[model samples]
Target: MTDDRVLPRAVLWDMDGTLLDTEPLWGRAMEEFARGIGAEMTPELRNATMGNSSVDALTKVYEAARVPESGRDFEADEDAMVARVLELFATDLRWRPGALSALDLVAGAEIPMVLVTNTVREVTDVMLETLGRDRFVATVCGDEVAAGKPEPHIYRRAAELVGFCASECLAFEDSPVGAAATHAAGVPAIVIPSAIPVPPKPTYTYRETLEGLTLDDLAAVFAAR
Candidate 1:
Protein backbone atom coordinates (compact mmCIF):
# COMPACT_ATOMS: atom_id res chain seq x y z
CA MET A 1 0.00 0.00 0.00
CA THR A 2 2.86 2.38 -0.51
CA ASP A 3 1.94 5.49 -2.49
CA ASP A 4 5.04 5.00 -4.62
CA ARG A 5 4.32 1.33 -5.60
CA VAL A 6 4.85 0.80 -9.30
CA LEU A 7 2.74 -1.50 -11.46
CA PRO A 8 4.10 -3.77 -14.14
CA ARG A 9 4.04 -2.69 -17.78
CA ALA A 10 1.66 -5.55 -18.57
CA VAL A 11 0.07 -8.61 -16.99
CA LEU A 12 0.37 -12.18 -18.28
CA TRP A 13 -2.35 -14.66 -17.38
CA ASP A 14 -2.40 -18.44 -17.42
CA MET A 15 -5.75 -19.64 -18.72
CA ASP A 16 -6.50 -23.25 -17.78
CA GLY A 17 -6.12 -23.89 -14.07
CA THR A 18 -5.28 -20.30 -13.20
CA LEU A 19 -8.43 -18.57 -14.42
CA LEU A 20 -10.78 -21.34 -15.59
CA ASP A 21 -11.54 -24.67 -13.94
CA THR A 22 -10.82 -26.61 -17.10
CA GLU A 23 -8.26 -28.99 -15.62
CA PRO A 24 -10.88 -31.60 -14.76
CA LEU A 25 -12.32 -31.44 -18.24
CA TRP A 26 -8.85 -31.96 -19.59
CA GLY A 27 -8.43 -34.89 -17.20
CA ARG A 28 -11.67 -36.46 -18.42
CA ALA A 29 -10.51 -36.19 -22.00
CA MET A 30 -7.11 -37.58 -21.13
CA GLU A 31 -8.73 -40.54 -19.38
CA GLU A 32 -10.89 -41.27 -22.39
CA PHE A 33 -7.93 -41.01 -24.73
CA ALA A 34 -5.88 -43.33 -22.50
CA ARG A 35 -8.66 -45.87 -22.46
CA GLY A 36 -8.91 -45.72 -26.25
CA ILE A 37 -5.32 -46.89 -26.39
CA GLY A 38 -6.08 -49.64 -23.83
CA ALA A 39 -4.43 -47.77 -20.97
CA GLU A 40 -5.82 -46.23 -17.83
CA MET A 41 -5.05 -42.78 -16.40
CA THR A 42 -4.03 -43.19 -12.79
CA PRO A 43 -4.16 -40.15 -10.51
CA GLU A 44 -0.38 -39.83 -10.61
CA LEU A 45 -0.23 -39.85 -14.40
CA ARG A 46 -3.08 -37.40 -14.67
CA ASN A 47 -1.42 -35.07 -12.21
CA ALA A 48 1.76 -35.15 -14.23
CA THR A 49 -0.11 -34.03 -17.31
CA MET A 50 -1.38 -30.86 -15.74
CA GLY A 51 0.09 -27.72 -17.34
CA ASN A 52 2.06 -29.74 -19.89
CA SER A 53 1.84 -29.32 -23.65
CA SER A 54 -0.36 -31.73 -25.62
CA VAL A 55 2.61 -33.56 -27.07
CA ASP A 56 4.30 -33.87 -23.69
CA ALA A 57 1.13 -34.87 -21.86
CA LEU A 58 0.10 -37.45 -24.40
CA THR A 59 3.56 -38.90 -24.33
CA LYS A 60 3.37 -39.30 -20.59
CA VAL A 61 -0.01 -40.99 -20.89
CA TYR A 62 1.31 -43.39 -23.46
CA GLU A 63 4.34 -44.18 -21.36
CA ALA A 64 2.32 -44.66 -18.19
CA ALA A 65 -0.15 -46.83 -20.06
CA ARG A 66 2.84 -48.94 -21.20
CA VAL A 67 2.03 -48.33 -24.82
CA PRO A 68 5.10 -48.70 -26.93
CA GLU A 69 6.21 -45.86 -29.13
CA SER A 70 5.37 -47.93 -32.21
CA GLY A 71 1.79 -48.16 -31.06
CA ARG A 72 1.36 -44.44 -30.39
CA ASP A 73 -0.09 -42.05 -32.92
CA PHE A 74 0.56 -38.75 -31.18
CA GLU A 75 -1.26 -36.49 -33.63
CA ALA A 76 -4.41 -38.55 -33.69
CA ASP A 77 -4.48 -38.92 -29.92
CA GLU A 78 -3.95 -35.20 -29.31
CA ASP A 79 -6.61 -34.28 -31.84
CA ALA A 80 -9.09 -36.61 -30.11
CA MET A 81 -8.21 -35.24 -26.68
CA VAL A 82 -8.56 -31.62 -27.79
CA ALA A 83 -11.91 -32.34 -29.43
CA ARG A 84 -13.26 -34.05 -26.33
CA VAL A 85 -12.06 -31.24 -24.05
CA LEU A 86 -13.65 -28.69 -26.36
CA GLU A 87 -16.98 -30.48 -25.97
CA LEU A 88 -16.63 -30.38 -22.20
CA PHE A 89 -15.59 -26.73 -22.34
CA ALA A 90 -18.77 -25.88 -24.20
CA THR A 91 -20.84 -27.42 -21.42
CA ASP A 92 -18.82 -27.64 -18.19
CA LEU A 93 -16.51 -24.64 -18.07
CA ARG A 94 -16.55 -22.41 -14.96
CA TRP A 95 -14.38 -19.67 -13.54
CA ARG A 96 -12.08 -20.20 -10.62
CA PRO A 97 -13.16 -18.45 -7.40
CA GLY A 98 -12.46 -14.71 -7.52
CA ALA A 99 -11.15 -14.92 -11.09
CA LEU A 100 -13.63 -12.43 -12.48
CA SER A 101 -13.01 -9.92 -9.74
CA ALA A 102 -9.25 -10.23 -10.20
CA LEU A 103 -9.56 -9.68 -13.94
CA ASP A 104 -11.81 -6.70 -13.36
CA LEU A 105 -9.34 -5.19 -10.89
CA VAL A 106 -6.50 -5.39 -13.38
CA ALA A 107 -8.59 -4.20 -16.29
CA GLY A 108 -9.93 -1.33 -14.24
CA ALA A 109 -6.37 -0.16 -13.79
CA GLU A 110 -5.99 0.14 -17.59
CA ILE A 111 -2.83 -1.97 -17.72
CA PRO A 112 -2.21 -4.15 -20.77
CA MET A 113 -2.68 -7.88 -20.26
CA VAL A 114 -1.88 -10.98 -22.30
CA LEU A 115 -3.23 -14.49 -21.98
CA VAL A 116 -0.36 -16.95 -21.79
CA THR A 117 -1.29 -20.61 -21.64
CA ASN A 118 0.04 -24.08 -22.35
CA THR A 119 -3.38 -24.99 -23.70
CA VAL A 120 -3.56 -25.22 -27.46
CA ARG A 121 -5.20 -22.41 -29.42
CA GLU A 122 -8.23 -24.49 -30.39
CA VAL A 123 -9.23 -25.17 -26.78
CA THR A 124 -8.07 -21.75 -25.54
CA ASP A 125 -10.31 -19.99 -28.06
CA VAL A 126 -13.35 -21.88 -26.79
CA MET A 127 -12.53 -21.13 -23.15
CA LEU A 128 -12.11 -17.44 -23.98
CA GLU A 129 -15.85 -17.22 -24.59
CA THR A 130 -16.27 -17.60 -20.86
CA LEU A 131 -13.22 -15.52 -19.84
CA GLY A 132 -14.25 -12.73 -22.28
CA ARG A 133 -11.94 -12.16 -25.23
CA ASP A 134 -11.52 -8.44 -24.62
CA ARG A 135 -9.69 -8.95 -21.32
CA PHE A 136 -6.39 -9.69 -23.03
CA VAL A 137 -4.64 -7.60 -25.63
CA ALA A 138 -3.11 -10.78 -27.09
CA THR A 139 -2.97 -14.51 -26.42
CA VAL A 140 -0.06 -16.90 -26.77
CA CYS A 141 -1.08 -20.52 -27.11
CA GLY A 142 1.03 -23.65 -26.56
CA ASP A 143 0.93 -24.57 -30.23
CA GLU A 144 2.06 -21.10 -31.22
CA VAL A 145 5.29 -21.39 -29.28
CA ALA A 146 8.23 -23.69 -29.93
CA ALA A 147 7.81 -25.05 -26.41
CA GLY A 148 5.27 -24.71 -23.63
CA LYS A 149 5.24 -24.16 -19.88
CA PRO A 150 8.20 -25.22 -17.71
CA GLU A 151 10.21 -24.20 -20.78
CA PRO A 152 9.91 -20.38 -20.76
CA HIS A 153 9.11 -20.14 -24.48
CA ILE A 154 5.41 -19.37 -24.11
CA TYR A 155 5.95 -16.69 -21.46
CA ARG A 156 8.68 -15.04 -23.46
CA ARG A 157 6.53 -15.02 -26.58
CA ALA A 158 3.52 -13.64 -24.73
CA ALA A 159 5.46 -10.70 -23.31
CA GLU A 160 7.07 -10.06 -26.69
CA LEU A 161 3.76 -10.05 -28.51
CA VAL A 162 2.49 -7.41 -26.08
CA GLY A 163 5.60 -5.26 -26.58
CA PHE A 164 7.02 -5.72 -23.09
CA CYS A 165 10.24 -7.21 -21.82
CA ALA A 166 9.70 -10.37 -19.78
CA SER A 167 11.09 -8.71 -16.66
CA GLU A 168 8.77 -5.76 -17.09
CA CYS A 169 5.65 -7.94 -17.02
CA LEU A 170 3.92 -9.66 -14.13
CA ALA A 171 2.57 -13.18 -14.60
CA PHE A 172 -0.21 -15.05 -12.83
CA GLU A 173 0.03 -18.83 -12.68
CA ASP A 174 -1.64 -21.68 -10.77
CA SER A 175 0.51 -24.70 -11.52
CA PRO A 176 4.12 -25.48 -10.74
CA VAL A 177 4.88 -25.96 -14.40
CA GLY A 178 3.39 -22.62 -15.35
CA ALA A 179 5.08 -20.85 -12.46
CA ALA A 180 8.40 -22.36 -13.38
CA ALA A 181 8.02 -21.09 -16.92
CA THR A 182 7.25 -17.59 -15.71
CA HIS A 183 10.19 -17.64 -13.34
CA ALA A 184 12.50 -18.89 -16.06
CA ALA A 185 11.26 -16.13 -18.33
CA GLY A 186 12.44 -13.70 -15.63
CA VAL A 187 8.93 -12.37 -14.92
CA PRO A 188 7.69 -11.93 -11.39
CA ALA A 189 4.50 -13.90 -10.66
CA ILE A 190 1.68 -14.20 -8.18
CA VAL A 191 1.25 -17.95 -7.79
CA ILE A 192 -2.28 -18.98 -6.83
CA PRO A 193 -2.14 -22.75 -6.74
CA SER A 194 -5.18 -24.71 -7.85
CA ALA A 195 -5.34 -28.54 -7.90
CA ILE A 196 -1.63 -29.03 -7.19
CA PRO A 197 0.74 -27.16 -4.91
CA VAL A 198 3.41 -24.99 -6.48
CA PRO A 199 6.88 -24.99 -4.92
CA PRO A 200 8.21 -21.59 -3.91
CA LYS A 201 10.62 -19.55 -6.00
CA PRO A 202 12.51 -16.38 -5.13
CA THR A 203 10.54 -14.29 -7.62
CA TYR A 204 7.18 -15.85 -6.82
CA THR A 205 4.73 -14.61 -4.19
CA TYR A 206 2.06 -17.15 -3.35
CA ARG A 207 -1.56 -16.39 -2.60
CA GLU A 208 -4.36 -18.65 -1.48
CA THR A 209 -6.82 -17.23 -3.99
CA LEU A 210 -7.57 -14.12 -5.98
CA GLU A 211 -10.39 -13.14 -3.63
CA GLY A 212 -9.93 -9.77 -1.92
CA LEU A 213 -6.77 -9.10 -3.88
CA THR A 214 -6.03 -5.44 -4.44
CA LEU A 215 -3.92 -3.59 -6.97
CA ASP A 216 -1.74 -2.75 -3.99
CA ASP A 217 -1.12 -6.47 -3.41
CA LEU A 218 -0.05 -6.87 -7.01
CA ALA A 219 2.20 -3.83 -6.81
CA ALA A 220 3.91 -5.15 -3.70
CA VAL A 221 4.61 -8.52 -5.31
CA PHE A 222 5.83 -6.95 -8.56
CA ALA A 223 8.12 -4.56 -6.69
CA ALA A 224 9.68 -7.38 -4.67
CA ARG A 225 11.22 -8.77 -7.85
Candidate 2:
Protein backbone atom coordinates (compact mmCIF):
# COMPACT_ATOMS: atom_id res chain seq x y z
CA MET A 1 0.00 0.00 0.00
CA THR A 2 1.16 3.47 -0.85
CA ASP A 3 1.69 5.75 2.17
CA ASP A 4 0.97 9.45 1.98
CA ARG A 5 1.90 10.57 5.44
CA VAL A 6 2.85 14.15 6.06
CA LEU A 7 6.40 14.66 7.32
CA PRO A 8 7.22 16.70 10.40
CA ARG A 9 8.37 20.24 9.78
CA ALA A 10 11.14 19.95 12.41
CA VAL A 11 12.85 17.60 14.86
CA LEU A 12 13.55 17.79 18.60
CA TRP A 13 16.57 15.92 19.91
CA ASP A 14 17.16 14.84 23.50
CA MET A 15 20.63 15.12 24.94
CA ASP A 16 22.25 13.04 27.77
CA GLY A 17 21.05 9.48 27.05
CA THR A 18 19.66 9.99 23.55
CA LEU A 19 22.32 11.87 21.63
CA LEU A 20 25.28 11.36 23.97
CA ASP A 21 26.23 8.35 26.09
CA THR A 22 26.39 10.42 29.27
CA GLU A 23 23.99 8.30 31.30
CA PRO A 24 26.79 6.24 32.83
CA LEU A 25 28.73 9.35 33.62
CA TRP A 26 25.76 10.78 35.43
CA GLY A 27 25.35 7.51 37.33
CA ARG A 28 28.98 7.58 38.38
CA ALA A 29 28.68 11.10 39.69
CA MET A 30 25.55 10.18 41.60
CA GLU A 31 27.34 7.23 43.16
CA GLU A 32 30.32 9.34 44.18
CA PHE A 33 28.08 11.99 45.66
CA ALA A 34 26.33 9.34 47.72
CA ARG A 35 29.69 8.05 48.88
CA GLY A 36 30.61 11.49 50.20
CA ILE A 37 27.44 11.48 52.28
CA GLY A 38 27.82 7.88 53.50
CA ALA A 39 24.80 6.83 51.41
CA GLU A 40 24.67 3.94 49.01
CA MET A 41 23.75 4.45 45.39
CA THR A 42 21.85 1.39 44.29
CA PRO A 43 20.42 0.41 40.94
CA GLU A 44 16.96 1.44 42.15
CA LEU A 45 18.29 4.86 43.04
CA ARG A 46 19.88 5.27 39.62
CA ASN A 47 16.67 4.18 37.92
CA ALA A 48 14.67 6.83 39.74
CA THR A 49 16.93 9.63 38.55
CA MET A 50 18.19 8.37 35.20
CA GLY A 51 16.57 11.09 33.11
CA ASN A 52 15.76 13.61 35.77
CA SER A 53 17.01 17.12 36.35
CA SER A 54 19.20 18.03 39.35
CA VAL A 55 16.12 19.19 41.25
CA ASP A 56 14.04 16.14 40.40
CA ALA A 57 16.80 13.58 40.80
CA LEU A 58 18.21 14.91 44.05
CA THR A 59 14.86 14.79 45.79
CA LYS A 60 14.62 11.10 44.95
CA VAL A 61 18.25 10.60 45.93
CA TYR A 62 17.78 12.26 49.30
CA GLU A 63 14.57 10.32 49.94
CA ALA A 64 15.82 6.92 48.79
CA ALA A 65 19.14 7.25 50.57
CA ARG A 66 17.52 8.59 53.71
CA VAL A 67 19.79 11.60 53.70
CA PRO A 68 18.11 14.63 55.18
CA GLU A 69 18.71 17.81 53.23
CA SER A 70 17.11 21.24 53.29
CA GLY A 71 16.24 23.11 50.09
CA ARG A 72 19.40 25.21 50.23
CA ASP A 73 21.52 22.17 51.12
CA PHE A 74 19.92 20.24 48.27
CA GLU A 75 20.99 22.93 45.84
CA ALA A 76 24.54 22.69 47.15
CA ASP A 77 24.48 18.92 46.74
CA GLU A 78 23.19 19.35 43.21
CA ASP A 79 26.00 21.72 42.46
CA ALA A 80 28.46 19.10 43.64
CA MET A 81 26.84 16.46 41.45
CA VAL A 82 26.97 18.68 38.41
CA ALA A 83 30.57 19.60 39.10
CA ARG A 84 31.66 16.00 39.21
CA VAL A 85 29.62 15.04 36.16
CA LEU A 86 30.78 18.06 34.22
CA GLU A 87 34.39 17.09 34.81
CA LEU A 88 33.75 13.75 33.18
CA PHE A 89 31.55 15.13 30.43
CA ALA A 90 34.28 17.57 29.47
CA THR A 91 36.42 14.64 28.33
CA ASP A 92 34.26 11.58 27.85
CA LEU A 93 31.21 11.82 25.63
CA ARG A 94 30.39 9.00 23.24
CA TRP A 95 27.48 8.99 20.84
CA ARG A 96 24.73 6.46 21.31
CA PRO A 97 24.56 3.82 18.59
CA GLY A 98 23.42 5.44 15.34
CA ALA A 99 22.79 8.79 17.00
CA LEU A 100 25.41 10.78 15.11
CA SER A 101 24.58 9.07 11.84
CA ALA A 102 20.90 9.76 12.36
CA LEU A 103 21.66 13.36 13.28
CA ASP A 104 23.60 13.80 10.06
CA LEU A 105 20.79 12.19 8.10
CA VAL A 106 18.25 14.57 9.62
CA ALA A 107 20.53 17.56 9.19
CA GLY A 108 21.26 16.68 5.57
CA ALA A 109 17.53 16.54 5.01
CA GLU A 110 17.50 20.21 6.10
CA ILE A 111 15.10 19.67 8.95
CA PRO A 112 15.41 22.25 11.70
CA MET A 113 16.67 20.49 14.82
CA VAL A 114 16.40 21.58 18.46
CA LEU A 115 18.35 20.10 21.35
CA VAL A 116 15.89 19.67 24.18
CA THR A 117 16.88 18.14 27.51
CA ASN A 118 16.38 18.23 31.28
CA THR A 119 20.08 18.85 31.81
CA VAL A 120 21.04 22.31 33.06
CA ARG A 121 22.72 24.79 30.73
CA GLU A 122 26.09 24.74 32.50
CA VAL A 123 26.73 21.18 31.30
CA THR A 124 24.86 21.73 28.06
CA ASP A 125 27.07 24.75 27.30
CA VAL A 126 30.09 22.47 27.58
CA MET A 127 28.43 20.01 25.21
CA LEU A 128 27.55 22.61 22.61
CA GLU A 129 31.22 23.46 22.49
CA THR A 130 32.22 19.83 22.01
CA LEU A 131 29.35 18.78 19.73
CA GLY A 132 29.70 21.93 17.67
CA ARG A 133 27.28 24.78 18.15
CA ASP A 134 26.13 24.44 14.54
CA ARG A 135 24.51 21.01 14.99
CA PHE A 136 21.27 22.39 16.34
CA VAL A 137 19.53 25.63 15.47
CA ALA A 138 18.08 25.97 18.97
CA THR A 139 18.22 24.43 22.44
CA VAL A 140 15.87 24.27 25.44
CA CYS A 141 17.54 23.33 28.69
CA GLY A 142 15.62 22.20 31.78
CA ASP A 143 16.98 25.04 33.90
CA GLU A 144 15.62 27.51 31.37
CA VAL A 145 12.07 26.18 31.65
CA ALA A 146 9.59 26.45 34.49
CA ALA A 147 9.42 22.67 34.78
CA GLY A 148 11.36 19.68 33.58
CA LYS A 149 10.49 16.32 32.01
CA PRO A 150 7.01 14.81 32.12
CA GLU A 151 5.69 18.39 32.48
CA PRO A 152 5.87 19.38 28.76
CA HIS A 153 7.04 22.91 29.45
CA ILE A 154 10.54 22.37 28.05
CA TYR A 155 9.25 20.57 24.98
CA ARG A 156 6.68 23.31 24.39
CA ARG A 157 9.45 25.87 24.70
CA ALA A 158 11.60 23.88 22.30
CA ALA A 159 8.79 23.71 19.76
CA GLU A 160 8.31 27.44 20.08
CA LEU A 161 12.05 28.01 19.66
CA VAL A 162 11.97 26.09 16.41
CA GLY A 163 8.95 28.07 15.25
CA PHE A 164 6.78 24.97 14.87
CA CYS A 165 3.72 23.81 16.67
CA ALA A 166 4.35 20.74 18.81
CA SER A 167 2.20 18.75 16.38
CA GLU A 168 4.45 19.72 13.50
CA CYS A 169 7.60 18.58 15.32
CA LEU A 170 9.07 15.13 15.96
CA ALA A 171 10.82 14.59 19.30
CA PHE A 172 13.48 11.90 19.66
CA GLU A 173 13.94 10.67 23.20
CA ASP A 174 15.65 7.79 25.05
CA SER A 175 13.73 7.65 28.30
CA PRO A 176 10.09 7.33 29.36
CA VAL A 177 10.12 10.67 31.17
CA GLY A 178 11.49 12.52 28.17
CA ALA A 179 9.15 10.71 25.78
CA ALA A 180 6.14 11.44 27.96
CA ALA A 181 7.08 15.12 28.09
CA THR A 182 7.18 15.38 24.31
CA HIS A 183 3.98 13.38 23.91
CA ALA A 184 2.24 15.54 26.49
CA ALA A 185 3.24 18.59 24.48
CA GLY A 186 1.40 17.13 21.46
CA VAL A 187 4.55 16.05 19.63
CA PRO A 188 4.88 12.57 18.22
CA ALA A 189 7.94 11.29 20.07
CA ILE A 190 10.13 8.44 18.86
CA VAL A 191 12.03 6.64 21.59
CA ILE A 192 15.31 4.81 21.08
CA PRO A 193 15.92 3.26 24.45
CA SER A 194 19.28 3.80 26.09
CA ALA A 195 20.82 1.79 28.98
CA ILE A 196 17.45 2.23 30.66
CA PRO A 197 14.78 0.61 28.52
CA VAL A 198 11.48 2.39 28.28
CA PRO A 199 8.51 0.03 28.17
CA PRO A 200 6.12 0.12 25.25
CA LYS A 201 3.69 3.02 25.48
CA PRO A 202 0.65 3.96 23.42
CA THR A 203 1.72 7.58 23.25
CA TYR A 204 5.04 7.10 21.44
CA THR A 205 6.71 4.87 18.89
CA TYR A 206 9.73 2.70 19.80
CA ARG A 207 12.77 1.87 17.75
CA GLU A 208 15.86 -0.11 18.69
CA THR A 209 18.33 2.28 17.16
CA LEU A 210 18.50 5.58 15.26
CA GLU A 211 21.45 4.37 13.24
CA GLY A 212 20.89 4.10 9.47
CA LEU A 213 17.46 5.69 9.81
CA THR A 214 16.38 7.66 6.77
CA LEU A 215 13.84 10.35 6.19
CA ASP A 216 11.64 7.76 4.50
CA ASP A 217 11.92 5.44 7.48
CA LEU A 218 10.85 8.29 9.73
CA ALA A 219 7.97 9.17 7.41
CA ALA A 220 6.81 5.57 7.44
CA VAL A 221 6.91 5.46 11.23
CA PHE A 222 5.10 8.77 11.52
CA ALA A 223 2.39 7.53 9.14
CA ALA A 224 2.09 4.23 10.98
CA ARG A 225 1.65 6.06 14.27
Q: Pick by lDDT: which candidate is best?
A: 1
Weakest 10 consecutive residues of candidate 2 by summed lDDT: 63-72
Candidate 2: how large is its RMSD? 2.2
lDDT of 2 by residue, 42-147 (tens): 8878887888978888777677667755533776787888788888987888888888898888888889899998999988988887666798999889999899
TM-scores for all candidates?
A: 0.96, 0.93
lDDT of 2: 0.84
Judged by TM-score, which candidate is best? 1
Tens digits of per-residue lDDT, candidate 1, 2-121, equal 468788889999988889988888888888888887777888888888999999899898887788889889888778888888888888888899999999999999989899998888
Off by over 4 Å in 1: 1-3
**In model 2, which runs have C-alpha deviations exceeding 4 angstroms?**
1-5, 69-72
| 10 residues in a row with least lDDT, candidate 1 | 216-225
